[model samples]
Target: MPVPVPRQRDIPATDSGPAPQASLTLLVVEDDPAGGLTVPEILDADGHRIRIRSARNLTEATRLLTPDVHCVLLDLDLPGPGPGEDGLGALREVLRIAPRHAVLVLTGEADADRAAEAVRVGAQDFLYRDELDGRLLSRAIRYAVERKRADIAQYKLAESKLRAQENARLERGLLPTPLLEGSDLRFAARYRPGRSRALLGGDFYDTVRTPDGTVHAMIGDVCGHGPDEAALGVELRIAWRALTLAGLCGDDLLATLQEVLEVERPCEEIFATLCTVDISPDGRRAGLCLAGHPAPLISRPGGPARLLPYDDSGPALGLLPRARWPRRQVDLGGSWSLMLYTDGLIEGRIGEGRERLGQDGMVEMINRHLERGLSGEALLEASVTEARRLNGGELTDDVAVVLLSRAAGRTPAA
Candidate 1:
């Protein structure tokens, strides 16, 4: 195991205090035909002695690298007899061997550009030989280590912010307005990412309606968990909305999506499963299509929840060039609810056994919640919470749920 180096806290560089103890050790690499650095002895500003383990070239440097050594001062000019171990090349080799070691280059004053390039390529800092001083050199080493750590932290922060912004844009495009101009049906959704620090995953949803009040809603999951998969999901969701608004539905829409995946996926095996529902204008019937996705669950007021019958739906997108997802129409009583969800909701392992809470188990769990009189947000919350509890941990796969309630003559708010 590699020893962890403690990050040194930054202290103001000035002349009036006792030098901090050199808990850290450093290695200095320079060419010395006369056997040692011709420069004078070095000491910290506070008069604390800085112990340096010196090496004449790459070969000597290799033997001096130890866990305690925290920094390296490499001379940019040195003759090479070893196969690929030139001066800068040797510096790079030292870095590969000791990645956590803060490396400083000792370059000629005229080679300032190369020094800067060294920093860009991962050296902590560069010290020009002609202008070298004991005090400034120590300060530069301290500052260089601190700055490299701070740079890493800032890069992580910026990456997180970029993810949040991307998720916000995706949310706006995927789950837009209900798109039901005059219909009283309510459409609500929630998405949670399984990636540790990401805001979204390969799960997406959207809703759009045509002129005749046929509201179509879709929820899908692209296989795998990553930014690329999430990006692909966003693209597919956008294409779904655009195609739906353009009057594409059923087989045609799915076929177009498969084509999109073939072109957009980073590689093969990145499949996508989807569940879509088209609610009639009167809100009494729904056209359901499943493409290697779980069937939507239905729950009428005062009745147990059950799954909508799913016929031989097609395979997931990106699996086959030509797959057919036939649509099934289901009757919806007034004041009934239907939920479309990704497979992440059911694939979580239950208890310590090999048993996974499959679609049937998920439906049964939802049905029990309904008996306690939970619906809407309450229903979803109770169901998901228990599902997690049964799994004994957070679901590792992305989860997305879209609930559509049709209570025509009497709105659900009643």
Candidate 2:
């Protein structure tokens, strides 16, 4: 049976202060022929009388061990272990039953070895019954609780670090690496996820130069913000790469991607916006395809940045069946730069207002950066960093930006 300890409201409050302390219920397991064990009234750090529940044996202890119990104090003197049996068998059982609670063990002075052994096993602390006092017991209880809390906190920290490392490895594999080994175009990209503590989002980009001397680059946004969308984006990027390597282009390539998106998406409402460009071998002309996506920005050495024509763009992938994305031809001149990006870049609010840094705003920002002699990787970093700055803080969407450039003296034919 369980017995409650008498409350002592008259005890002088300890230095730990007068703040109302949350009372901790301590379960005491002991066996005495005198019916119930007598424990000195103990007060917690905050001067509140510590509540106590006494269990005559392990059976009662187990029955009384509930989530509300904060600590367990076991008496190692309980009889049961035979000659060859472990002396701490009762303590071990208590630990197994209340693994999450702080524990203390009580033993006689002569059985000091057993007390030490009890602490080694799992008990937070052990006390010789002869040395038991209200003050000592109070401090021990407080110490044990704090130690257990620290242990649990350390374990959680280690677990979170392990999860982060695993996520980094997975993200490295999921994000595509540009394949521009023999191509003259200089490639650079930047990506950021809107999710707090996340490394990747639904935005993705890839650039590859095929054997036919045509460089294909793409950027897309899976219309949502999470791992599911990020996963879908990876799948689409890989599919596009494979189909491009196999010589598919324009509407044919997009049609196949739409089919893949429709079949693989989590639901029918899920869709993706995409912008793809196939630059010619001479870097003088290119094919542009926009699947309900923002047009790519183009900039030449002496001209202002502008958006490619989006008049013939088709509906976003997965939005309609048999949708045709007309591949429009655009002249890239000899020396030019193309920037393909997800909507996250332009969707951020400008100057803390309801107004967004739309395509026009983005174009103006890029031209400003270009005027300052920024190009390639420097240009991309500056552009994205500025967008985040203008938004007043981090943008709450996944952003991906890719830059492919042809220098004035460095042509593909050269």
Give me the candidate number with maximum TM-score.
2
Q: Which residue runs of candidate 1 sit more than 4 Å off their true CA positions?
A: 1-22, 29-32, 38-51, 55-68, 74-144, 163-178, 410-414
Off by over 4 Å in 2: 1-10, 13-17, 22-25, 29-38, 43-70, 74-100, 105-136, 411-414
How does candidate 2 fare on TM-score?
A: 0.81
**lDDT by residue for model 2 (21-75), tens:** 4877788888865676656558787666677788887888889999888889888
Candidate 1 lDDT by residue in tens digits, 52-131:
68788777888898877767878877644467555667667767776767788877789888788878778988887767
Score candidate 1 by TM-score against the native: 0.74
- What is the Cα-based lDDT of residue 13 in candidate 2? 49
